[model samples]
Target: MSFEELPHQADVRVRVRAEDCNVLFAEAARAMFSIMYVTCDEGEIERRVSVTSDDMQSLLIDFLSELLFVSEVDRVVFSSFDVVITGTSLTATARGEPFNPAKHLGGMEVKGVSYSGLTITRDGEGFCSEILFDV
Candidate 1:
């Protein structure tokens, strides 16, 4: 697996390309958000993940979904990304935070990152489980 950080307008863009799907998934998951058990090809296939209107959950979900959507829609697997977290919030084109895809293309379908096991610790970092569509 290989990873690189590409330049972007706003938000974080991670590009990852791995020979092993599992390892690729792990790296991508780690980059997108902190996670415990990276989903496997045999586990309960996750196709979508949602976030609450409040808190970091929204930003997290939006960020991961865009990756997956990009992978599905575009033929590119992101090996790295450029992340920009400002004032604990962001702005995007559509609903939720906006990200400029033209700047960073992490080609990978990431259905959604869930809030089920999400734990925003006091230190301001935590873990969560995300659902990937076809990965």
Candidate 2:
């Protein structure tokens, strides 16, 4: 897995493979380390989990919710994520600035993943997918 910040944009680029969660999580953490917008104790976060679902929409919701749950509990906001899907499961890892309630700027609130603008289909090699977040 790998992530890089776009120099001119406010977005991050994420690439990840589905075989392992540890590698993906580490890459996400590294990407978060590069953010200049927030602060927190790097040692506080200690657990990671891989979420699985039958479809892309559900997988996306599950993945983002995991991140949101951590942020709300730890008061951190992640800025980047990489997701990979295999079989009926999804592996996602994320990175973001540490949570600082004192210096806090609001982060995005993601509702559950929606079927709107969501698509899943098979091409020659394998399945291809795209989804739009509610933001």
**Per-model root-mean-square deviation over C-alphas:** 14.4, 6.8
- Which lDDT tens digits does candidate 2 get at residues 24-134? 443434333333233333433343547887765566556655765776676555555555657657555554555665665443344433455444445344343333334
The per-candidate count of clashes, in order, stands at 23, 1
- Which 10 consecutive residues of model 1 have the lowest summed lDDT? 34-43
lDDT of 1 at 4: 49
lDDT of 1 by residue, 1-135 (tens): 344444434323445554433343345544553221122222222223232335554555555566556534543333333333343343322111222355333434334555444333232132223333222
Of the candidates shown, which would achieve the greatest TM-score relative to the real structure? 2
lDDT of model number 1: 0.39
Task: Report lDDT (Cα) of residue 95, candidate 1.
Answer: 16
TM-score per candidate:
0.39, 0.47
lDDT of each: 0.39, 0.47
How does model 1 score by TM-score? Answer: 0.39
